[model samples]
Target: MEKYDNIDELTGLYNLNGILSHLQGHETRAAEGSIVIIYLNVMNFKSFNQRYGFVGGNEFLRGLAGEIKGLFPEELIARTAGDQFIILANSLDEKEITDRLTMLSEASARHDKGLRLHIKAGIYQQTGDETDPVIMVDRAKIACDDIIRVYDKSINFYDEALSKKNELRQYVIDNFESAFKNRYFKVYYQKEVRALTGKVCGYEALARWQDPVIGIISPLVFIEVLEDVHLIHKLDLCIIDMVCKDLRDDINSGYAVEPVSVNLSQLDFELCDIMAEIDKCRDRYDIPVELLHIEVTESALTTGADFLDQQIKKFRQAGYEIWMDDFGSGYSSLNNLKTFDIDVLKIDMDFLRTFDTNKKTPVILAMIVNMAKELGIHTLAEGVETKEQYEFLRRIGCEKLQGYLFGKPTPVDDFNRAVDCSFDVCEDFSLASYYDRIGEVNFLGNTPLRDKSFEIFNNLPLAIIELQDDIAQCIYANRAYLDYLSSLGFASLSEANSIYGTTNHPDIVEFTACLKRAQVSPDHRAYADIVTNGNTVNHKIRFLFDSGNRQAFAVVSRNTSIHEESDTAESLRVAMAHVFNQYFRVDFFDEDGTVDNIFLNADQKSVSDYTRDAKEAVRLYSEMYIYPEDKERFKKFYDITTVRDRIENTKSAYVVDYYRSATPGDNGRMQMYMILPFYYNGKWKFISLCRYADEIRDDDLK
Candidate 1:
């Protein structure tokens, strides 16, 4: 009935039926010519189809068929599946077949821009014993699959080893659902230790599959196989759900549970809504967002794919911490860091191992640590297997560490046991020394300052100034110092000091000279008498210099005659200082909905605009940083009436709420704003702390 009954409608090629019927005649004359069956595949055809639509994919196939026909017109050809082409060539050697295939690839690329094909092939040379076309085709397909599995290989011949691997892969695919139903999959975790303290801060989740029939399968092998079969998303989602359930169980059982990071492939986002999937598991198990972390590799971000950008934003907005794993293994590793809102930079252990052999490796590692610090991003060194690598990274200011040195990834029971007894870093390891190496001049807890001096600095009756530069500038000062300046009708410490005339004041002059001398000597101090507020008081000015941070500090302690301010002003000062030191930006709005003051902690490496002008600050907050969809909501929340009502109705001393906005780095990542309305200076003033959404928690806010 049909003229070419076995012809493929799309490619005009002989279908499998026609090819097999044609092959029946060739089998009788096998001895007359050498027969080689070649199976060609369009690698990543699904990705191409996704990148371009179905129509585009079909067009590419049609163009590819034309090129294949031009190269092998006399050979028997067939369209097997969507992206596979089979060819039976006679009287041609292996070299001739290779040459023709290479030519066909180039011609296809030249014909149409969209027709460039990444071809992988498998070959089977027919023997005199072979008679069935189905057997030969199956062997060729197995050979093709071997080349595809390697990915780097272009072609492979059918062999026993490749056939075995194919059989294993088929077994996995056929029994995947059964294995899952029988609870064969498992989630393992490796502890991530704090480098300075050696405390187990968190764990990284890894997958394990135990097949009853096959005993155990390596994750690397099975993960690749799952990806090939488009079942990786199912596995990834399963792992997420398992991790969440485990976290909930651990908490219920009173096991000290830490956050666990999970690896997600690019395909996970492509297959379904990643955010929705996460929400499904989170809601099902009632898991807190902070208990889970998302890890994407450096290579994944290097693809410059739009899907990653969209998915990352949604994850961040939903308060999920994002870690960039394998930091230095990609071509665009450093560039990806600049573009992504990656909270932790997990340096690959390969970089550390190379330090012993490569002269420039340590320098590069140091540079990465410094760059990450300057960008306000924390660094985590992964795969640390030796004491030397751990010390080296600690010295270079890596915040977190994880590897074989701590302990390998283990099952839930083993991980809990290992972490139960707590561990400490080596006895000789000093956190202060590590801090010195990183040039951290400011200490928050348990500082080495004299006890009396520390108390006076916080609860002093006078202004305490900490100068960080050679010039008469203040980097930090206590609440008493700020209040004193405000009492003098000065808006800022800088303005008040300028009016005091530091050049003529002997104490100020000596303080500047002491800082310069401390650049070379550690123990440097200068004392002098100066008149302030109509009183001549003795002042003790000490120069503290940190060579590592390349910073010089002048700690000036003088007797303050005034100890108290208006209750509201004092409360405002304390809140402002705490918010400023912790967050990148803090804004204080008056009861009239006007920005009264703004404090910005700008990273030198990043672009920033921190204008003190109230009107301009309001415009920047409302128009520039706030996303279009959130602007109206943000405005409504911060309105004068809304603020007054919230503070009154809220039982807590401060009314706390959250809103989203933009930051200088990673435009897609919205900054979480903790808006608190407090009674300050006899009116309702809202103080908002601007931080990355991942770092905030609803429970903590409440």
Candidate 2:
């Protein structure tokens, strides 16, 4: 009797109803022995399918299975799954384990024109501690994954976390593969609504991947891997060009869906001919110059100034718009604002996450909003998952928000419907669903209340939270909170009531303690004004609170969620500025005596890369000295004097213009920037700007 099923496709575990029945039938006469599961998967089988076609695929797999059955003398080998074989070794000598499995692999390779396949196998000695067969299989699979991820060929036992992680990773891999074939790629536009007047100012274009068979694969896996393989340029072109064509068709039809920003990775700039490609697409679709915006990260701006600046200049000359994406998401220390010629500066969702209605995240977002306002840089944030996060952004003078609170990234059809609907110019959305349904009637000892509480906690849309005794012991917040905390080096809530003082950061342990107290208080609030650790933020206990077991506080956030307007222009310059100013900047002296500033401006950040004021913008005047009237002029001149001079004088040490952006949005306004190189004090530096930005109009030009 076979111990496992034949058509199983998943990696980790398999159901054993068939095996149990087989065991039950023999219960009276068969002697019982331990169920030793020898799980083996031909490593890189997925890669194999991609490399070779089906004809070759079947020959190799079937050969391996035949070998497994023929060679193993003491165990029950079964075709458990695709490219994954399992054996129930009962009452077998443990010493012959390695030799038996190795022989099967060697025999498979010895076939005609065979591929050199490597295998990573997991061995689980199941003694049956109320263990389900499926769970046992999963344990073995996880052990295999653990070894493979770290590139180890050694055997692995069973670890619970490894199993769970393996399950999640396998799900991602399986779903992502299906996603690539289906229409998983899409761009969702959120209207950048002006909070004060409630006008449809523009839109922020967000990328989303959704597949019919696999559901949604978070950008975390696919986007990054694609970028590494230089496939992002294709994805960008597909999405951006699609937005451009859609906008033109919409405008021609009079539906009023404007041009918007499409996010571009730092790697996107490496193509060298990005501008040419964009221009070709725009012209092909008959799209106007006022309708495009190219945006990039701030760190990219500082380093990739020359190539990007050249591209931005071409876009500007051709009448395209420019922007700085992920503003306040990283180091803005050196005030690289002037270096890239940009129109909008996306205030990262991180700031919005920390915006406190009751000083929860604090109005610290105001600093960013006010800065953007003074500089004439438009501000928008993605990942605003709550009403509080949305409202705080608006109150602090921000004009846009995008998150689950507004709506998840939907398909083009769904997006079009939303754009034409009534939500054209408002930031208000709903969050009560994310919380407990307060109106539900509870009948049994507050069991309903408990259920509601858990529902709210488990479903708290954008963040991962940990609570103890009605107070939150820790929180793994969304992208927004992470960016803000990175500048302070206050990341990692693994430990309670602990604070680390980063370079150029003020210790906020005292503030952390107060915030902890508030979780249990009537108001449920606390406050802190800590500095970045060496100009970065880890943002620990930025607002840790214990919102009791009972539906505790009324949500301690300020980022008011907003509705998406399909037709608004989505610019990327703002998003670029957000990241550079908030999280990245590395000060390193070059041969010319200039700091060859290095920064890692990515679409996401790990918990560790926070706690310093972004690379080098000094706290004194860098944060608050620019007057509204002269902000643009001062920035321009500063970039020329510092970044420009360094690059020029050093005879190619650096250049003012280093990065490029090609963001697509819906405001009927596009953004791009140019960085000029210079040399200062025998050192190279960069200067940049997007003169076409709203922040740098004639009034601010000086």
| Candidate maximizing lDDT | 1
Model 1: runs farther than 4 Å from truth?
1-21, 24-34, 43-84, 90-117, 126-132, 145-151, 196-199, 228-234, 249-256, 270-277, 283-286, 297-304, 326-340, 345-382, 391-398, 416-702
Worst 10 residues of 1 by lDDT: 600-609
Spell out the clash pairs found in candidate 1.
439-549, 461-560, 462-560
Taken over the whole model, the C-alpha lDDT of each candidate is 0.68, 0.50
Q: Mind giving the per-residue lDDT tens digits that candidate 1 earns over 177-263?
A: 997898899988887877766666788999998888788877866787888778888999999999999888866765456678999
Query: Per-residue lDDT of 363-471 in model 2, one digit per residue for the tens?
Result: 4566655544445455666667776666666556565555667555544566554455334533222321221132222221212234323232221213433434433
For each candidate in turn, the TM-score is 0.51, 0.36
